[model samples]
Target: MILKLISRSKQLVPHSPVRILSLYAVLALLLFSAVLLVGLMPADAHAARILEPKQISGAFPTLAASFNPHEQVGHDQMENMDHGHDSGLSVSTALFYTARIVYYTALLMAAGMMLWFSGIRSGSDEQRKRMQQWSLPMMRALLLASLLYVFANARSLMEGYGGGGPEWLRLFTETNTGQAWLALLILSLLGFAVIKASDTFKLIWALLLLAIESWSGHVAALQSNMNLGIVLDFIHLACAAVWSGGLMILLGLWFVDRKEAGRFAERFTTAAWISMALLIITGAAITLLLLPSLSYLFYTSWGIWLIVKIALVALVIVTGALLRARVRRGELPDGLMLKVDAGLMLVITLIVGVFTYMSPLPDNTPVRFHKMGETRHFTVNITPNEPGTNQFEVKIWLPEQLGEPSEVKLVLHSRDRQQLAPLEVPLAIFEDKSYESFPGFVRTSYHAEQMDIPFPGKWTAELQVVDKSGEKVEESIDFENY
Candidate 1:
């Protein structure tokens, strides 16, 4: 269907500068609004605790901490979580995304140069000379970007770990991300040494580099049918590189000679369309695998970002179709349109970098566990046992002689006794109607409430209930916070 639409839109019509400007203006407005909406929306406070540092050390504490370096390490680990965007502003994360953009841009440029070299036979002498002129510098940039990516990634990992030494080394040597980085370093060295290699070899190596990148992302963490996920991810990364990289090369050549660039642009448009089709298909499949339901697409932060990416990609496709139409008409392609398309692609790449670090699952639902009360005959089901905010659901079942409880209260006690007072959880009745009786005892009521655990450790929950007869029953359940 996409191909048919592209084919139908291929006929050249008069290029109107006003229309082009208007199109871009609309796109800019849409993008700005989407960003503003995301910014204005409220972020989950509990979700932020999972990623951001909760506090900053005071000057006096820092000075005193210098005497005990190990204590500082522990403090840093406790402070630095998974570094989610909702948590806070993270300089390390910003740098990491910057590094990713540079690295991927360099990779695409290298791949574009290879694509250009493969078809060097079809172009004029001047065009061939232009390709040779840009080739070495692009390869050198790729090597530099690859090295910078490694350094930035290592620094980010160190920040997450609180410090780096043997731990960093272990991560690099033992983890899948580390293995992928090691492979990329080797490829970078090879690329540097063979700057003037055959086009096929360079292209093959570039694809390999991108494939390793796929292994470093969320796809690699899949436990069910892992091979299928990795294969789809590799194809997605490869197609993206080819489409974007080819454009980078075309943009450069278009400046040298628009007439000469038209021929290559025509060929690239066909390839780009094919790449775009595959991207949409693979992207949809991956999204379905990761997302729990359609509701998450709007309700979760991850889904909002995915929507932004889809919008940017739609802009790219529209721009590509217009460029192809201009090329087919034997007219100079719209330079402004091409630039807009390339800029959007770069922004999309940065979004991809952000997504790589984020969790796809919604924060509202987490790991759940149930606790049974021995004397009170009630069960408390805790949704998400993590050391942060949680929801507790209580279900009470009474014996044939005992009536349903009239009141229930939840209390939290710190095992270490460091807290000044036990925290109380105010639970409201969720379902109070009596259950149908077929057995000796009948199920009664259920209550639920939200609570926060400030720290990770052992804690005890005390449930106190007042029966219909005014008899009070107390039961305690112990659990550990992650």
Candidate 2:
């Protein structure tokens, strides 16, 4: 069966595989069209994704209000965005994800072709010819995508974190997200220089490119077990690139010559098989890193996108198996199935580009409580304000009148449920500048903190302050756990 493709390459075919690839090209465009439509959904509409998406993936999409899972586009914010402004935001977002999608496709395709051709032990001429024809364009796409991602990402970040920023150039150099963007831009430039380099050089280039992807991803953002997360993300990305990139190059080769392409396809199917195995394995490892809990899969937008990606991947695998079976039986494959397989891979890439940019930590909205008593001010702030174990910080203002309080306690109580027992955590000295006492102020600031929340519900936190005179001034505010 493999011999058929090898022999067929030597013989002339009646038609160009260009039309078939043109079919793939149309499918690719349609895939992008779908991504753009979803990306440009109304601001509030985007906020409700779960039944939604995770991107803006790989770059600037996180800065786009439409795609940032951590910073939701609230109704009030959306209401403020009149149709014109809304349209502009949507367009900005659309460009961000679109460029990223194109970038991923091109980078993987270029790298995959390098590996594909390398499989031909003796076809030095064939390899060199294909590299000359294809490598530069793919690298150019990477260069172009990186530039757009930088511009859009900088713009989005400035809008979010700026008066327009700490400034855009500084933003890239000083921040984690920005540094990663810079790496992408720099690496892509380097990619162009190495297009015609040796197979070993190409392999290194591909690994480096995949590494850039890992840097911006949720796996890299893990507060704990970061090394494991990065490994999982890299392996998963490599497998995906191999599978998708190899298929794309193969289709292009089929357009050139079926028999010659067959030699590569025989090797590629083996690569695809290995890649699929690692894809599943690394995907599971990544899930453990990204998913907060099993229940999140059923309810969160991130979980839903993951579920869809899983289903799409399953479809791709089944289709490929059927097509490979046909090849094994000494029969020709219907080119349409291959196109479908390619199309599905593209869609999976789209899904990944978004969610991979999503926050690994599940929803943790900010929660704060502030109130003034006769002689002191009390406050509590919860970061990522979500259920389960939570960080609690309490601040007290000790006027010259109150002096320093003898003790401060962060006491928590349930207002709506009985199962939740009351919790009291003494905020020990917070020596960090943000929590430290600022000198020369009329009112001294005292900050204390603990991390021990066990659940989420309607609750009340009471700030208890004891004066040196043995009197207690207690202030309480009703707030809910996130």
TM-score of each: 0.62, 0.62
Judge candidate 1 against the unseen true structure and give its global Cα lDDT, from 0 to 1: 0.64
The residue-by-residue lDDT of candidate 1 on 430-471, one tens digit each, is 655545343555466555544766544457888888877788
TM-score, structure 1 vs. true: 0.62
lDDT measured at residue 35 in model 2 versus the true structure, 0 to 100:
38
Q: How many clashing pairs per prediction, in order?
A: 0, 9
Which candidate ranks first by TM-score, i.e. highest? 2
Clashes of 2: 9
- Each prediction's whole-model lDDT (CA): 0.64, 0.61
Most lDDT-accurate candidate: 1
Q: Model 2: how large is the Cα RMSD against the reference?
A: 13.5
After superposing candidate 1 on the true structure, give the runs of residues whose Cα lies further than 4 Å from its correct spot.
1-86, 119-125, 160-164, 364-482
Give a tens-digit lDDT track for model 2, residues 353-449: 6655454335446777776655566667766555544566666666665576787776778775656677876566654455444343223344434
List pairs with backbone clashes in candidate 1.
none
